[model samples]
Target: MASLSEEEQQARETIRYLVAASRSVPGGALASAREDWRAQLAWWGSQGYHGVTLPPEWGGQGKSFLVQTMVVEALAEADANLALLYEVHNTLHLEAVWRYGDEAQRRRWLPDLLAGRRLGGFAVTEEEAGSDAESLATVAVPEGGGYRLSGVKRMITGAGWYDQYVVFARVPEAGITAFVVEADTPGVGFGSPEPMLGLDSTPVADITFEGAWIPEDHRLGELGQGYAIALDLLDGGRVGIAAQAVGILAACLGRSLAFAQQRRQFGRPIARYQGIQWMLAEMATDFAAARLLTYEAARRRPEGERQRPLYAMAKWFASRKAVQHALNAIQIHGGRGYLRKTGVEHLLRDSKVTELYEGTSEILRLVIASRLLNGYNWDSI
Candidate 1:
């Protein structure tokens, strides 16, 4: 592994401090901060977390992509839900506007979003467009000087709560187009938050657009560019999710190590036993490997399309290991890990979502295989 630069080290320290501040609230250590998310979001924004990867001229920190991944990892250690929200906002929503939007659009939305006064969402997934994102059913019909979008986007993070959304819909002449729409648009409505398995703090819901009017200026890039934009945004988002997986795995490993050291069985510390020792060693190894892969993906993000398969590999391996590490942590804790209060069980649940989102484990495997079969050259490989 390469040595960390001063900028990366400083960024990690800043995120660590910010995460620690958000860890405590009115009621004990803010475990999930489910009810206090509003305050937490604002606090994180105030601390400059939302703009870590944005340009300095845009009132952002102008940090490197690698640094941003480190921040995401630290945030995930504090709360996976908040980490996901942060990743979506910065990597997907904000990046889309910065990379594709005109100056006027950037001036209109970037300030409030970076300051954390407003939140943004990326809406692309539909009821039937999970892995098959190209099969979008959303329609964008031209009307006068603008278009009226009509579609229902499902599993949107910050759906009802976000101030604006970067939506994707199909145009009659175009294949898939991206548009920015405010949440308060006349025809825009949100469904109740779904009862999800994990990410309780950042509940997702369906966003329905019933002829929601979108001005021409709100369109991102050229017509039919949504597919490319989604792929670009997802490449970055996958790296962030890999960082999140590393965070969760780190938490599980740390807890399990402590538990093994203290919990005595048959009059000796469990840590002394070879069985417990091997589990800890494996957890540590996975954590190291996952973190390295995530960092490598972030570092190679500037290479664009050529490095996409690396993102998929990092996300898949890290998330898969995260789930397994969570289970191992629980096993080490025995019956105590089964109890919800121990928090190990919660980590297990959170790890499951990492594999589901940002391209599932199965999908990512296909992506990596496709790249390899095509004779793509990766230095490390």
Candidate 2:
């Protein structure tokens, strides 16, 4: 990656400092425990880490998206689960509300959201609608001064934990509508938690609504715009995923390099051997390449021009690279890497989630291909 400006460099150092300062806090292992993750997010919010991209009045630092990306990457270097939590908060949840919600809604929701006093959830996925968000079965019907929402949202990241939920539901005449439903609403309920392979820190479950009623003011944007809003959020949000991928790769590379230099084999350090050196060299190069791609996407994304392909490209490449690097790092560590005690296994487990979330590797490829077919920003890629 090219050198950052003085301002950007300062942003990087600031986030790095915050991440380093939080080292003493029990985050990595703590993240695997469901109940403990709320405290983790609160601690980060106390550091002003969760408000990078939010407005000044919203308890955020009012930083640029690039700075938020830097913060996310730094958080990932220390704790992947924390990084994911931040991404979900800033990119996945708050960004949508801030960008699409009306002024009154922003004033009402942004405070607790940015302060970490209240967690927010994005309710879009359904049992039948994994990638096809339009196929969501959740529906909202006009009732009195509000709408009655009835449906189930599965695979919600903060299902049982969030204080508020931004739920997308089909309306009788308005098509898909995004509603801000309080988690404790009379008709709101949570299902049993789902078991996960990684990111166990962030609890996942289902949110079911049975005629959940919220004021008409709770709607996010104009009626029928929920799907479009969600799609737009995902387009730029993929950059967060890319940054996370780079972060995971950085951690894997650092751990692998340290082990190679310290672990002795064949009567000398393995770092001295050509085989080990080759693996380290490849990991370093790949990590750097992934970082470059991620930063490029972060830089170009907010311009709001024809940048979808770039975002998709960054996510596809970086996420795939992260998973591969984690596996390769494990390979270099041999049996030790396969074991949980080495911490390499954790990286491998966490890195796999990158490929599966935001946009799956396959979905990203399709996005890029579709944009390319339409000649959208063809020269840039």
Candidate 3:
């Protein structure tokens, strides 16, 4: 991995200490963040994490994308749920508004977001449109001075917790379009959070838009541009997910190394054994490689179209390694790792979702294959 600048190194250290301190409470960081999410959000905002990549004029630190990814990795190492929420809010919502929203919209939204008065979410996936995102069942019909959105979006992070959402719905003649809808809109309703195996700290629910009225100004970008905008947002989101994976992988290696050193068998520490040594070696290698892939993807983000496949490769490989290392960590811990109290199992659960979202492992393979078949030079990326 490329060496971090002095500023980046300082930022990483600061966030790592902050998160480690916050997670020191009972049930660790995940439980604390989950139980008191509002407070956690406010804390993150006060620390300037919500705007790490935004311009200074917008009340942000105006840091580079690499710095933002570094912050995310630190958050993930301490708390995967916090990292997931941070990634979704910054990469998907804040980025969308900053890059696509008009001046008026930015003035209306940026302050509250920076202050933690409002949290942002992106709503796009539907029950039938998980991987095939374009097959949206949500529809927005033109009305007087606005549009009426009526459809359901499933698996939305912060579905009820978020103050506002950037919703995507198919228009009669405009195809899929994006709109910024306040959660309290007259027709917006939310279902109960879904029960999941991992990352339980992060809430996921379905949103129902029963003819919600959105003013013309709420529409993001031009008509028929939602698909492109969503794709662009996903590129950034993929990089964030990859960073989160790197964090999880780091945690897996750290926990396994400590366990191997202290764990004794046959009158000796397990770290002295060849089998345990090999597992630690592989886990360490995976952590290093995933970090490099994620850093490369973040560095090349400005290349636009060329970076999509790089994002895919980084997300895919990093997430896969994270899951593998999590399992290995558990094996190294034996009975202790399998138990929930150990907290090592949580990494496995959190790592599995990385492969399924932004783009699934199956979907990412096709994306990379398409790039290779197009005769693009793989070395250039």
Determine the backbone clash count of candidate 2. Answer: 1
For model 1, residues 260-282, the per-residue Cα lDDT tens digits are 99999999999999998999999
TM-score of 1: 0.96
lDDT of 1 at 322: 94
lDDT of 3: 0.87
Give the TM-score of each candidate: 0.96, 0.95, 0.96
Better of 2 and 3 by lDDT: 3
Model 3: per-residue Cα lDDT over 224-286, one tens digit each: 999999999999889999999999999999899998999888998899999999999999998
lDDT over C-alpha atoms for residue 101 of model 1: 87
Residue 26's C-alpha lDDT in candidate 2?
52
Window of ten residues with lowest summed lDDT in model 1: 25-34
